[model samples]
Target: MGGTWMQVLGLNWLVLSVTGSAATMGVVVMLQSLPVLLLGSWGGALADRLPAKPMLIAFQVLRALLAVVLLAGDSTWLIYAVALLSGVVGSFEGPVLGRFGSALVPKESLGSALALGSVLSSAGRIGGMALGGILVGITGPSALFAINAVSYLAVIGALSLMRTAEMRYLPTAAPADRGVAAGLRYVRSQPVVLIVLALSFVLGSLGRNYQVSMAAMVSGPLPAAPRRTASSPRSSP
Candidate 1:
């Protein structure tokens, strides 16, 4: 997941560097997020019904495959499509990993376990971003994507080594059984939850476009000229 974020930043920077177009970067970023926004809940339901370990493995493989495909693809549309699909797969992977976290630790210690998990995740994100910037500076974004693909393989291997004997998939309770129209309807039935959901939607719709706003600002009202260095001259007697 950290690797995915690294790949995303590297890819965006690389594409923008090559195209010199902020609009393209915005489109790429939006495409990368669209699937998670659209399909994340469905992904969570699917995760509940499926085995977490295998689901994670499949998602990682899908991400790796997309990375390899992007390596071979030059078209922006191809990259966009791959990125969107990766997000969808990643949505499923997110909840699956969360469930796996529970299985990996004791029930009473779950809170501490999850806290440590989050700390490590944040560390990975920061480290991966720094490493990605260096990698992009030296080799290019495609190379970073390739490295991310391999990192996904390492994750798959780690998941495989985990014990799964007691880690059975918890059967999803049917919506009908819960006396709710659907998950959304159930959520909406609670006033606090409904308000939170509405606020989240509003924020996501407006706030998530900050990248576009930044790009526009940089290109429009606050354009900065590229810096150039002058050569030094020496005098001889």
Candidate 2:
């Protein structure tokens, strides 16, 4: 969550600096989210079948590599490509992490675990944004990208140290019960779950794209003349 928030802050600043156009930044943000919006259900289905830990490790590695790519390139097209890839990996990673979290506690303690998870996620977001904003203002977005890449290593390392035997593993669904369609059917059978998911989808799609708004505000109202170079300085504008 920290790495994700850092990337969000750094990416928004970087996009504004590079294009100096809020419209282009909006398009980039959309490209980043498009994959997740389209394939999130498929990703959840995959989570139902795959082992979450290995899948999470793989996704984290991919995200770290994508960050490295962003750090290494200056092309707008390449940035868009990295964003797309990150979204693809993130779509799966989100659900896998949720399921993994559920498995970390007994059924009776699940509510507490989820509540704690929410608190931690909120804290991580706040810390990441604060630190990322400061770091980007000082060192630049590339440095934040590098730091985020290293953060992934910390997560991978921690996951590596976890004992699988101690985890409360959820049983894999039968073959007939697996896949996107099956998941949809299950959701449809549960009215409360279906309603919640529908509301979440609406909220996430329409109301939750803070990066787009942030980029527009920075580029529009908070304009600061950046260094006249292909690589723009990562400072507030």
Flag regions of model 1 displaced more than 4 Å: 167-171, 174-181, 202-237
Candidate 1 residue 234 Cα shift, in angstroms, is 41
Q: What are the lDDT scores of the predictions, listed in order? A: 0.70, 0.81
Residues 91-189, candidate 2, lDDT per residue (tens digit)? 888889989988889999999988998999999999999999888889888888888899999999999998878989688888888888888799889
Top candidate when judged by lDDT against the true structure: 2
Taking the tens digit of each residue's C-alpha lDDT, what string does model 1 give over 1-237? 578767866666545544545677677777777787777777767666677778778877888898888788556667677767877776777777777777776677789988988898889888887888677767867888888888887888998998898664344677463332366676867899988888998998888776556555655577631111232111111
85: Cα error in model 1, Å: 1.2
What local lDDT score does residue 185 receive in model 1, on the 0 to 100 scale?
71
TM-score of each: 0.79, 0.90
User: lDDT of candidate 1?
Assistant: 0.70
Backbone clash count, each prediction separately = 0, 1
- In candidate 1, how many Å is residue 209 off? 5.0
Q: What does candidate 1 score on TM?
A: 0.79
Give the backbone clash total of model 1: 0
